[model samples]
Target: MDMNASPVPKAVVVGAGPVGCLSAIALANLGWHVTVYERRSDLRAGTHHLLAPNTENNPRQRSINLTLSARGIAAVQAIDSALVERLLHNAVPLRGRMVHHLEGNTTRQQYDRGGHCLYSIERGLLNLILLKAAAVVKNIDIQFRHKVQSVDFNKNTLHLCNLVSGQELDDHFDLCIGADGSHSVIRHHLMLATQMEYSQHYLSHEYVEIRLPQGVDSSGHEAYLLDPDHLHVWPRGSFTVVAMPNKNKTFTSALFAPKSLFDTLQYPDTLIPFFKTHFPDLLSLLGEKRLVLELQSNPRSQLITTKANPYHKGAVIIIGDAAHSMVPFYGQGLNCALEDVRILSILLRKEKDGHDPSVILRVLNHYSETRHEDLVAICDLAMDSHLKMRHSVATWSYMIRAFIDNILYAISESPSLVDLSETIFGPQVPSWSWLPLYSMVSFRPDISYSAAKKKAERQERLIDSLGVAVGTLGLGYIIYSFINLNRLF
Candidate 1:
């Protein structure tokens, strides 16, 4: 399989999540006969998965609301510009981070000098669009309720068991993609096949979904408890709560807490008192009775962060959550997975021996090596932000430094900071060598995402010091001139 020269082959993608659906979309566009196997039923069935409150108070309601920042939008735009625009309709553009203090005083920090908004959207809606797009492609077929049980990478074949009927079958493909997520069967098979170093850590934090109702405001468009145009974050330090609005006048809220805190929550009786005390006025719209019931009934989702040394074998490759799973605090989980679809398509089209499974493995290894640093950085940031969200604003020292940092972002995001903002928002610049942070985060044309991040950080330090030096020099010159005038007089 010389990757430098062949046509598209039969590709198998496991998982029907956003990442998996996007992979199927990309592969089909690249002219491959792509098949996607998912364990869940089709999302387009429109069966309301959300049991929380809605405008109609209809118990059957739903939303997978997520903060879709520039990086995510860029990735989506790269794949299909129209889909990006279509998704924007359901999204509320957030101009900046709206920090909600316990006292009710708020601060708005813009992300871009031009006031660029990070779109917030429903996750399930995005998945449906991707799935529908894949359905339209003649090269793809999506099989729901088909669970992949195992893979024999050596033989270029996969073993799958039907999730519904308990029927087992074996199939072969030129390339197999494990976009199945953290507990990917493909990733598991790859680990057993070769010498792969894998590490997984379950963080101390936990997340449980909460609800906020939608009501008509004084003006009459749908009204929400929190501002709809912004991403609402209640940073409390040890724990935090955030909300993203949906089309239904209601807002989907999540509570992130330490295991200890969640474990202590048992009955509805204690739940309301605690929420009202901790979150204060937030419970006004969300009623104490409902909050307590949700805390007791809703499951607390665990956070699992992981990394795999190499992502490929003779016929298999793992992408999305399978390759690197991080916490959802950053809201990049689904978007990052979609980005993988784009990257994979680029690689498949470029590889000369496109049909050869062996070549695919080599490419997969290169992809893993290149992506490692960025994945690690995001995972760590997600973990650290828990502290930032819950407590940093409360500390004067931390708040001051953060304010300065925000100012820097405002400058960097400026068009005057053209090269700077582009780098800050993502990794796509070609010429301007950015500091590691800039490079990894935004300017990534030349270097790998990891190396770029390193450069962006180093650049930030020098840039900050340069400002200080110029200010000091100006002050010194003014003082010297005044002394000379005084002496002359």
Candidate 2:
């Protein structure tokens, strides 16, 4: 029953975030001795933390940007099917993105024609689910307020400081995983082991979480104005406000803008005015009094972008935000992190099984070298999607072209296209360790990424040609009919 029992190694995981919790559970499932160390006090005591908060006294809120996309759902389902059902029941199924414009025009773009939906769920809800799942694993032990101060990789030991008791701990384990997020102590130790190429950049964008309470119509009842099936967005070029429905019949909303914009807020200043102007419907939902308190009280988080080579042999590995952190505009940050766990877990089972310690080390290293491209691809795609959502929706050319795409897609039938959508969203594809989204999503047996990419190009070309040909034929038919009518007259 114990997959790791050959050596019967003890594994210590740093951080109690979603990725760390999942990693601890996965290893414990495979019979590894998993002990999770977290610096935060018992959240059981209702302890909530915002990485950064304002000095002003205001009612604080708990909110995070998370989109459960197809790939993310698959990653989650692979780990636990029960969780998938529970999450689906709790989440607001986002059938598509609802783009709201300055001129009061709204557009809906569907991810699939069959009404298949991704979801918008609160990050804290999802994390709570993962933590609860991990809590049930028999071999997993969790130590709250145990902050890791240093790591000794050569000796495979850790020096930890207890945040609550002001105590210190030195412990040994077979593996050390730094799921402690972007500012990882374990990752810091890995820098001492190898020349790790790492870069972290903070985006000009800053995010402030707000709430859009479900309001009632003129009748004495509560209601959600917008379609609960969609993720709502008011893209204001450089700044934006987004509303995603919650199970509580409320929608958690966030406003993202530059710091300069927030700094220019005066007494009775433009913040509320701006919201009331650009997001009239939303401002009405989140009352003016509550909006002021939220902006003046809640935390303003800096958007960070990070990239790193995650493996330094068997001594260290980083998952989730610890490796790559992108702006939440694309809504894949947490999803990508969960997907990382899926990849490493599969790789550990496939390549490390029955291998010597040294052999396992080599396998881990190989997986690291291979996973970079997919990381980059996803990171890039996430970044590009922001442009399409925030700015392109307002462009005439963008609207026209997207409509054309919808029409062309309607006329075409590609097994690969259908398979591609399913595979990307399906939970059964092999974790190729490092595979393209299309290849991994579609699970094409022999199609290399280069070939798949070329095919995508050809498909696009064919769709464009069909659109042109059909338009021309329709025009010709119209002219001929007009000539016949004239002759009859």
| Model 2 lDDT on a 0 to 1 scale | 0.69
Top model by lDDT, which number?
1
Q: Model 2 Cα displacement at 29 (Å)?
A: 1.7
**Candidate 2 lDDT, tens digit per residue, 138-223?**
89888887878888877888899987778898999877678887777777787777788888888777877887777676896777
TM-score each candidate.
0.83, 0.82
Model 1, span 236-345: residue lDDT tens: 87888888777776777888889998877777666777777778767877777778766666667777888887787776888888988877765667656666666666
Q: Residue 191 of candidate 2: its Cα lDDT?
A: 74
Residue 211 accuracy (lDDT) in model 1: 69
lDDT of 2 at 467: 76
